[model samples]
Target: MNHTPVEGFSKLSKQEKIDWLLQEYLENNQDFKKVLEQYYNEDADLQKLHDEFSENTISNFYMPYGIAPNFLIDGKLLALPMAVEESSVVAAASKSAKFWLNKGGFKTTIINTEKLGHTHFILNVEPHKVLHFFNFKLKKKLLEATEAITKNMRNRGGGILNIKLIDKTADLENYFQLKASFGTADSMGANFINSCLEQFGKTLKEEVSKEESFTEEEKNSLQIVMNILSNFTPNCIVRAEVSCKIEDLKDDSGISNEDFAWKFKQAVTIAEIEPYRATTHNKGVMNGVDAVVIATGNDFRATEACAHAYAAKSGKYKSLTHCTTDNEIFRFWIDLPISVGVVGGLTNLHPLVKFSLSLLGKPSAQELMSILAVSGLAQNFAALRSLITTGIQKGHMKMHLLNILNQLGATEDEKKYFVNYFKDKTVSHHEVIDEFNKMRNL
Candidate 1:
């Protein structure tokens, strides 16, 4: 699909860029497939993956939230859907990306993905061949366990795509691993696969029969490492890109494109070398990625853990993404495992989550992944532009005005006045109090 081409790149004006993007998204946003109800039917796997089981208080109330607007992704413009409550984040992302839009808008793309998953069980036994027992006899059982998961995935044109076993550091003395692969369909598949593993594990631990004299010691030797979801998701990899042109900044207060570019680079540089800064930088990345993940009912914790873990994999925590420029065109890129899906998940549960998923319509896993990649890029652009331009405090302070206004016991109109007033001034708490007193006296 041809897009408006990140406006200011060649010779387009910032308004020209935003106009083209808004027009393009309005045209395409309606045709997508969207599912709003959880239609449960018998399948080999799905019944367990989205298991609400008995009511658990924790998940019962973590409803979907919003990130507000001002970001666009893949071939669409979005206010950027988010399910978080950290006050400044959504506004910060909106403010930053809006700033970039005036410089020609963000350009982004998402690449396809491949996957691998592991199920490790640590069993320390007197005999050495306990781990070896499965190699010869469990082949059929492994296939049976895996095959049980294929029906749902296959219906959607994917299934037990592959399977393998991994050995964690054997030198660690008591560690071992068992891993399996099941094509996740258009969902994260954590529940689907975990249920299969749990049921099969019960079968594995149970005696083949009472006819065979299997000792209690043998049964007790088994130890479950984790029969839950995995953070080492490689099946999905998302890559995104965003760029703007020097001419896009013509309307900025007084900064040059080259200066803003340098400033943005310096801010990213801090994130690269400093862990303290990197966490925030990476948080900005997740600020975009996690919102969409939660809206679809996928696990946000796993995505968060894996994302930062990936950024710090080099031992020195650094940026999960990098920004670049070629003469007049500035660009941003990020690659990370964002395991997510729309089927067999909470995407079908909870009133609002299901509603949010429907609002997005039905998107293929890869297609949805592409959308996420673009959000990440737009979010990163938002953060960098703020740092380089008027600085972080400008937009942050505007969103923060509400918190302070509430504290001052301002009426609704008074709060609105304060927010506009706060947007127009340099910030300090005393300044807020002073403004409050002036308004109250009036």
Candidate 2:
């Protein structure tokens, strides 16, 4: 399938990129071309806006935009929009939502809402001198220097809140970090945080150079490494929990309520003690969190990095969620550093993102953090329940049957027949293809 490379691929217009790629690789496949074109919005203006989101835009890559309804959070009903391609994610979330709807739904609390960034630099000054330079008086000077950069953020009731000097001389020779915390309000504040850090880095170097108390060696030794935001925002924590009497867990799954609680707790316990299991366990949690984050135009990549770092905060990777059963009551919850925002970035730009935000009544960043945490908790519960009882494959494969049918090019009638056929049977891609071929022949 090797083909000659095209020059200036990035410079090509969207249509030209599509034409060249199709002509080079996809021969005589007007059907494939039409399928891609059909996903584009009819509005030219909106299409153009999407095209400019990234370079070399040939077509819009689509994920199934689904809604998981019946989520009761903080006494409010929310139908979360999940943009994902996985088969069982929406189903799992929906099942969890319905199961907990009558059990007081989910409750969320924002413990703290502070984002962090770092101005990494090398300083060979005495430890005391370094500490004194970042003391109360000097910290104010740092903020003063970045006042112009933080003007808009401060006007919006958010800006650089504090700067702390961290000593890392033991870890690396003369290494240090300037940690800055910010109250970004409703924005993710990556750009704002970075801009402030850059200014602080500049201010720190200047302050050192002019300090009569500092030796010439200390001034020359100071070198700015980088200024950036840290996604592992432990201070921006939110807790989401769902609790119900064990007796209330009765469902069609045939498992007793007490047994269900026991098994679910055990599953979570394994994740806590075993890093191997914990990795995949946390991935399942993100399956729910990332979907809602992406749908609402938040940075899922950042959230993923923060969540994983939080899991390993104890020096060992562990589960993000915990389950407890006491006095005939069952409780499942997760505490996650959910640094999400409901404004800025794509939130205000993308039409679907605005609609997603509106669906949740346009929550503040703290509220959104709670919602995202609960989603992860709910998804984990749903997956664990399936894993311990009927087995994960049973429900997952059923949801996956449609993808198999589509892959084999099943018509509407064939799809209906195969869907019913596979409902009472196991599904496999090869089996689906074989049955599809057999049906066509018949």
Candidate 3:
């Protein structure tokens, strides 16, 4: 089986690409080709739009889009759109939302909404000389150079907030940074920030070349390394929290409200201290966050990177969520540094994404940030509640039972029977398979 690289793959048509893949790798399996085409949008325009979203398009990969209803955030009742394939994420989020609804629901605060970009360069000059040049000459020129790029943003009350010169020579030889902060209004503003940074880079080089205060050697020594927006937005912060009287925190697990509150706090405390537990703990939180982010046409990868980095911002990997019981009032909260936009990107392009945004009443970027933070907090609360009470697997495995039955090729009637059978009994793969086999045999 010899496989050789092909040329001009991107030049090929969609059908041609699929044919080449089939002949080269899949042994020309028509069945597999059919599987690929099955997921394509029936409308040609929509399919073409999806294809242009990335390079080397072949087929659209699908995921389950679900809704978790009854979310009360900051005195508003909203249902979140979640695009995830995992079995229990939507269920868990919905359960948590209902549990907290009567207890004043989730309260969120937009702590900050400043996004950052950097123009990194290497300059073998004295720190004071560089700082003097930046302060006296280059900073104003940088802002002036980006006026064209930022006029629209400024009109919307969002634009370049400030730019600072950072000296990083100790960390690396001849390393310096021009850190710029921005407010992007309702958009994520990656392109806007990057455009401004690149212009700043150009202006810095131009200013250095013309300045009489700098020696020719110093001017030539300055090399622009890169200009880009950072995904690690620590300053773009949102806090989501839920609290209730300890006596009101009752559940079907038979644990007393006080006992439940104490145990829940203890579980969160362990996650705060233990890296291993914190990793899984945060993953559960993202399960909810990413789902909504994707459904709303935001960048989930950037959101995840920012969140994980924030969890470790305190010099150790710890939980994003925190718990406290003050004078018999039990409280759980999460402070997330997530930057998401409700406009631009796929928000207007994708049909489902448009529907998702409309479903949320067309929130601003700040409101979306609060929504994401609350979703994550709700997910964490549900997971912690289960862990402290009946255990994580009982409910999770029950949700997972359908997948197992489907794997064993169970019919709808069998699925219904097993669903009822496992209503009281514990669910496991082997046990379900065993019971399924016995039922079929009988």
Candidate 4:
């Protein structure tokens, strides 16, 4: 195959990119072009708005937006919106919500809400001199220098919480950091934290330029490598928990309540001790967390990164959720570092995001943290129950049946018949296709 690069590929118009790609890749381009055009928003203004969310306006890709209801959190019933492509995620969340509804639901609390950022610079001078400079007066000066930038955040009861000097010489020679923490109130504070760090970096340069505490060599040594927000927000944490009597676990799987509780706890223990199991185990938790985060227009990518970092915070990768049974009482809980925003990003722009936030009673950032934590815990609980009892594939395949039928182009009547037919029998792509063929032939 001969390959040649297209000049100015990025600068090309969206349609031009589409046309070029189609021409180079496909024999019949019009059919695929029609497929792309079919998904374009019918409203011109609405389509333009979606296009500005990213560069190179392609057809709007979509995931099913679903509502998992019956989530009773802190004595309030919540209908959570989840935007995910997986067939079983929403169903599993709904099932877990209902299961916990009668068990006093989920109790959640925001432990803290402090976002962090850092200014990395190389200090050719003694580490002690930099530490002393930060400790003596530079810390206050840094905060003061950023007052203009943080004025609005301060007025809203949030601003710089603390500043510290970090010695990272062990990692890289002459490397040091000015670590700062902030309270961003209802916003995720990425921009806020970065703005503050940039200001601090500039101030540090100016302050060292005139400080009599350093020689000419030390004065010229302070060079800022970067100043940016850290996604590993350990201080931004939330805890969500659910508890019930062991005898209260009712299921059709024919397992006794005691056995179910024991097995569930054992499953979690396995995740805690085994790194291989823990990765997928926490991934199931994020399936619920990311869904709700996306629906609410929060930064799920940052949240996922922070959560996985927390999972390994103990020097070994482990489960994000914990399950236990003591004295015939069952308890499931998770304490995770999740940084999310309720007032910025797409919250104001996306119509569906506004509706999703309003549906949750317009929770503040802290309250949203609790809700997100509960979501992950509930998802983990549901998955463990399925894994131990009826096995995960049974329910998962049932949820996947429709997608398979659609792929095979089964008619409405055939779909309805196969849905009921598979209620007792195991479902698979081949089995569904065979049944559909037999029914259509008849």
Candidate 5:
């Protein structure tokens, strides 16, 4: 039976593929469009507000995009995106995910550290005498602030787990951090964390202000150098694993299971010691992970920054995932921060964007991340598959050649011939011209 294709989506036309994507984007992000119109359009006064809050704006605001599908994270299936544009990203992740498809899929857990951070001012008053002050009518500001934080989270059934006030008296440069924890269902908790932070900051200034010395300038300077939320996500976490059987991998290629296992093992090991290789190494992981980020409307920039930062936290770049081949099977695993959320911000506001979020039965950040981690492995597998057999460009360059030809207005037959001719060889503009003339004459 021929199933009807989705509206505005044809399996054929490249433009249709892109159109389908755009349609999905619009359907899910209705609320976001208004926000964008108000805040991000070319002439919005939001920039003025940003300047008032901090001198710098958030960097890399433009999201990179790609999709990872056929994923089951924490036993639930999903289709997600990686908001990055780098090569080998989505491919490697999807490849890796597919490789482990037969394994019990991916299992994940979310640890919701429902904590919000608040800034404490260090006035540089008396070199050694530093104080933590509250802005409240009765000087019960801390309690009020804590109660608000707790109440906000509790309303969501997360309920604040704990609250702590920290003072760094030893270092003048080190001020104070107010840590509060809350719950995020199945995600790493970035959404609630960000909202709570914003709420807490506003609450401190307005709900309680006993002493007026706690000025906006000081608080603004303390919380951010850029008018942006910190990438340090305080929400959910994801832990995932993939298992594959050796028999499933063996096909007509006469490629022994042992050979495939040995090659993949060597590749991962070599990646660990070589930064040159490891950059692509982790990119493989992000290929899967980032796709989930974009599909869900979470901050891909933050996730990317955290992953790269974590990679270099040891002072040298390295892989964030582990892979191994056991008796008659292969297994891969990843544990990374997927603190994205389901019910807030751009995800909820943007109509088209909301559709994207809902595609997965309303997944949490870790559930999303786990699906991505597997996809990342799949993407890695695709790259490796190409490397082992036909070389990476054979399939890629062939498809690219036709894409270029189409851009030049190649007709259906022309596109077909151009693709075939370009296969087993690379063509030049002159060759393209010759093909065009020949096709026109034919």
Candidate 6:
């Protein structure tokens, strides 16, 4: 079937939009409309709010919201809210949290809280002249131009920290950058930073145009390329760590405490040195981190981007987590660079997000960063523990048992039976299906 693209799709109402989608893409299937409408919010106001979150909204895509209790971070016990669909993530985090609870839990330190952005422009002026203006006159003008924008932030002990002029003519013809650092306080300051960068861009053109030091040709050559906030916040860092006596690391994994400690350390070392291992290792860490991030209405994409970049900061992709076993002590930790906000974006609008923040004790931005780092650390520990012990498939497949049962169309009684049956036996897709077929035949 040939489908023509429809114009003015955004101008249509919600039902009209769905009708167009069904006719063009879904062949006007009534069942598709039912499926879309089934997930719509019953409250008209809430549904409208959801629709306005993005364009051409037909329905809501939902993920399971779960809580992992028993997290002890910085001497405070709290339950973490996680939003995800994958199996075993929440369970693994909770298990790790409980394991380390009595062993002094997770300790975190805020290393830095600086975010940055850049204003890119091009000017055909001499490098020395550009530097002189930036140092003496342009910097002040840029700061002065942003005073109104930074006022409330400064009142709250956060604002523009410093501005630097970086020459990039070697990379491109007459290219330059105004690198600005910021402190955002309790919010992820994307809008604030971008606003300031745009002002800087305007100030750059204006100041360079009026400068008597520059010729008319040089002044006209000035072009403001773009102004944007960078998601790669390396200085916005938090460190989460857990440590205990190696002798106390004994578990039912049939391995000695000393052996387990050394093996764990070796696994982390392999990830640190090998790129292949590090990719999967860090993915497990993000499984925990992203869950909490989504639950709290923060930007997971930015968090993920910053983390992977930080991992490869040494010119090679390595593990974000580190482990050490020395002097009869075992330590595991991660220095995560992530930016999150508790008082902005969807925090005030989304009902569940509000509940999630309150559930976390209404933490500040710094506290949220620590929680995110700890979640990543706990997830890494859980994955490594399973990997070094009974193997990952054992626990992961057990958690996956119900999904398999549902796929096989097992009844409630059959599901109950398989739950007990797989308790001791190994679970494989073919074996479960074969056994299920046999039970049905019998």
Tell me the lDDT of candidate 2: 0.90
Q: In model 1, which runs have C-alpha deviations exceeding 4 angstroms? A: 1-72, 96-116, 123-140, 169-171, 199-224, 246-251
Highest TM-score: give the candidate number.
Answer: 3
Candidate 1 local lDDT, residue 204: 54
* Per-residue C-alpha lDDT of model 3 across residues 225-278, encoded as one tens digit per residue: 999999999999999999999999989899999899999999999999999999
lDDT of 5 at 42: 58
Query: For model 5, what is the error of residue 23's alpha carbon versus the real structure, in angstroms, after optimal superposition?
Result: 31
Once fitted onto the true fold, the runs of candidate 6 whose alpha carbons sit more than 4 angstroms away are none
lDDT of model 4 at position 302: 94
Worst 10 residues of 2 by lDDT: 132-141
Q: Write the per-residue lDDT of candidate 2 for residues 55-173, one digit (tens) a residue.
A: 77767888889999999999999999999999999999999999899889999988988999999999888888888777945587888898898998889899888888899999999
Error of 1 at 321 (Å): 1.7
Could you tell which candidate, 2 or 3, scores higher by TM-score? 3
lDDT of each: 0.64, 0.90, 0.95, 0.91, 0.56, 0.94
RMSD, candidate 3, Å? 1.0
Model 4 lDDT on a 0 to 1 scale: 0.91
RMSD of each: 16.0, 2.2, 1.0, 1.6, 12.2, 1.1
Better lDDT candidate (4, 6): 6
Model 4 C-alpha lDDT per residue in residues 239-328, reported as the tens digit of each score: 999999999987669999999999999999999999999999999999999999999999888999999999999899999999889888
lDDT of 5 at 208: 27
User: What's model 2's TM-score?
Assistant: 0.94
Clashing pairs in 3: none
TM-score per prediction, in order, is 0.74, 0.94, 0.99, 0.97, 0.65, 0.98
For residues 1-442, write the lDDT of model 5, one tens digit per residue.
2333475343335334434444565554545444443444353354444333333332114454666666666666666656654545555555545545556666655444332444444333222222434322422444455565457555656754554545654665645544555555444455555565555555444532333554554444443211123455424445566666766666334677777767766777777778898898787667666666666666677778767776676688877666688787676655565445666656665544567766766655545555555555556656666666556665555545655676778778878777777766755666777778887885
